[model samples]
Target: MRFRMALYPLLGDLKTICLTLAYLYGLTVYDASYLALGKLLSGDVYTADGKSSKRRRGAK
Candidate 1:
């Protein structure tokens, strides 16, 4: 019977993988502005929920 004890190593690897994913996501969002072509092609670039671009005064 072989009882596995690779928990620590597995956890460390998982942590590294998660960090890398987060890093990539952050980079993508950070460079989103530079990739405006794609967004424009997809459609509207402004507005948070695709509602309206007009900002009402004193509604901040």
Candidate 2:
């Protein structure tokens, strides 16, 4: 079996975007970080938290 890992630095722009997402979505910075990263990578974000998932779906 093989696995791959990629490291991404959380720089100023990403940090600022996370902070903005946190404020706009009423989410903690921690949660917003996931969203920010997903947006940056043009990928989807999946969460175990049902409430958060619901909120995200509703936002779309």
The prediction achieving the highest lDDT against the true structure is: 2
- Which tens-of-lDDT digit does each residue in 9-60 have in candidate 2? 6788778878888888788788788888888878888889987776556322
Put down candidate 1 lDDT per residue, 1-60, tens digits, no spaces: 989643222234444443443354443322333223323335443435322223211112
Best by TM-score: 2
lDDT of 1 at 13: 42
Q: What TM-score does each of the candidates earn?
A: 0.26, 0.74
Please give the RMSD to the true structure for each candidate, in Å. Answer: 16.5, 2.0
Q: After superposition, how far is residue 26 of candidate 1 from its true place, in Å?
A: 1.6
